[model samples]
Target: MVELAGEILNLPIPPHDEVLPYSESCTDKSVHDLNADNVVLCRAGDDNQLGIILEIQREKDKRKRFSWPA
Candidate 1:
């Protein structure tokens, strides 16, 4: 997020420690062990903080790609 905050958004990165929940899931019960940079943003020790999902994807070369993600 330091990269995102500083490079992309040009904003200050929060000093608070980040908590990356292991296998954070929603209604679909999906997993990210093999896919996605599906991030949930939140400050530490705040259970009431509803995180927003930030899905980061890299563009694939269309010439070599066979399938696309949904």
Candidate 2:
């Protein structure tokens, strides 16, 4: 796992009309601050969702090799 400090990064989803209660272990700010093993936790409807970045794909795009929690 790699971390990027003081840089802009994107999450899996774009901003939405109604965003549920969500927590990303690695936030845009966290990425900018350079945190590792990023995980996002959120609620939608009646479900719990997570977006996890297992690895970084590219430094150029800061492309994240990520997955959803099960």
For all candidates in order, the CA lDDT equals 0.47, 0.37
Segments in model 1 whose C-alpha atoms lie over 4 Å from true places? 22-36, 47-53, 57-70
Model 2 TM-score on a 0 to 1 scale: 0.22
Q: Candidate 1 on 1-70: residue-level lDDT in tens?
A: 5445456756564544564654434433355343334554656566423343445546666743443232
Model 2 ranges off by over 4 Å: 1-36, 57-70
Tens-digit per-residue lDDT, 1-70, candidate 2: 1122212454354332332333334445335534444434344555554333443445644223343221
lDDT of 1 at 65: 46
| Overall local distance difference test of candidate 2 | 0.37
State the number of backbone clashes in model 2.
2
Best by TM-score: 1
